[model samples]
Target: MKFLIVEDEESLRKSIAQYLAAAGNICDWASNYDQAYQKISIYSYDCILLDLTLPDGDGILLLKYLKKLNKNDGVLVISARNSLNQKIEGLSLGADDYLIKPFHLSELYARIMAIVRRRNYNGNNVVKYNELEIDTSNKEVKVNERLVYLTKKEFDLLLYFVSNKNKVISKSAAVEHIWGDDADMADSLDFIYTHIKNVRKKLTEAGCKEYFHSVYGVGYKFTDR
Candidate 1:
């Protein structure tokens, strides 16, 4: 899963990012509220680890702004404050969970998985679409009981398609979601076509029916034939 870690503490932020990366998660760091705001406005994350105290502004205010924007991004508030009021307030402001400072990295990982499961898969560890199954915990994909090999980007792209099945996804949206804001430097979306082509080829070779459809002038959609 993709995550954004918002914390002013350099050591803590790096620690969280490294630990989560080791566990097969893509993590981005934001040192302060402004950075966090910029990241949030530009990209969509599976989950966000928010530090209540930042160099520029209160994390609670950011939480409020996220809610105001109607962004349903899952959030976990990681703060030094352990007061009942703070916890209650954070939850009320739309945080999915809270983690106090000085906590174990393992616990943080568990909390993130829990929140992601609840938010994306309805607390299920696996995401299934027709004959295909995605083991989120193991980052494995299977089609018709046979394991399908996939690169990280391919897996992420497939998951995104599955999650938004039947919806048209523009090339720009696919690039931004899979490659982030840096995709603007690319000369064209030919690379995106390449990725989609490979993903479709792999799935087809695995004896699966075509579920990914190119929308010609528009984009692509995942739909069962």
Candidate 2:
């Protein structure tokens, strides 16, 4: 999953980013409100770690802006403010979860996983399609009750396809979601084709049907039909 860390504290931001990265997640950091706003305007994130107090503006306002863009991105507010009113206001303003300062990184990771599952997969840690079962919490994929080893990118690719089942997902959208702002640096989207091919091969080898389809001049779709 892709995450945006909007914390002004340099050490904390780096620590959080490193932790999430180690867990096979792509993370981007923003030191202040302006940087956060700029990043949000350009790239879409699966989840955001936002600090309520920033050098330029309040995080609540930024949260409102995020909602305004119809992103529906999961947000976990991390703040030093532990007042009841602050927590209430942040939750009421569409924050998915809240974590007070001085918390363990493990707890934060758990919260993030919970929120991501809730937002994208309807709170189910396990996502099932036919004989294929994906345990999002464990990052495990199984076919017919047998474990199937998948590279991190391949796993993420499959999850992305399943999440948007039956919809035609553009190559550009996939690139941005998978690679984020770095997509701009790519010379071509040839890499996506390679990943898709590998994912399809793995599933087929596991006795799964071809659910992924190319859309001619458009993009790719995941459909039973």
Candidate 3:
């Protein structure tokens, strides 16, 4: 999963990113509203951990912006404010969930998984496409009941592909999704091709039908048909 942590506190932001990364997920962060705005404008995430307060602007406005752009990115508002009106307003603005500050990282992760599952898999933990069965909760993939082991990156790539099946995913988008926005500093995006190739090879070897199709001059597509 890919997530953006829009937080101001350096310690809390790093803590969230580290916890999510340890669970095999990609995470990017912004210390203020402007930085967060820039990232959201350029890249989309499976979930956005939003902080209501920022140095430059109110985080609530960001929610309004996402609504204006009609982006369906799941948002979880994490704030110290416990007011009922604030929670109500955040949800009304399109946040999928809300968590109070100083909460357990485990609980935060669970909420993120729940929101992603609801948004991408229609609230299901298991994803099925032809002979492929992915247990998102367990991070397991199976081809016709035979387990297919995958590295964390490989698993994330497969999930991203399946989530947006049949869409043309540009190399830049794939890089941002799999490696986070920090990958923009990398020398090249050629590494993306190698990862995709490896994923295809592994799935095919596991008896799963080929579902990945490379789009010339664009990127790749995963389709059941």
Candidate 3 C-alpha lDDT tens digits along 137-208: 899999999999999889999999999898999988888888886787989999999999999999999998
Instruction: Report the poorest 10 consecutive residues by lDDT, candidate 2.
Output: 173-182
Quick one: ranking by lDDT, best first?
3, 2, 1
Error of 2 at 193 (Å): 0.7
Better of 2 and 3 by lDDT: 3
- Estimate, for each residue in 82-132, the C-alpha lDDT of model 1 and write its tens digit: 899999999999999999999999999999989988988889999999899
Which ranges of candidate 1 are over 4 A from the true structure? 181-185
Top of the candidates by lDDT: 3
Candidate 2, residue 161: CA error in Å?
1.3
lDDT of each: 0.89, 0.90, 0.93
Better of 1 and 2 by TM-score: 2
The TM-scores of all predictions, comma-separated, are: 0.93, 0.94, 0.96
In model 1, the Cα lDDT at residue 219 comes to: 91
Q: List pairs with backbone clashes in candidate 1.
A: none
> Which number leads on TM-score?
3
Runs of candidate 3 with Cα error greater than 4 angstroms are none
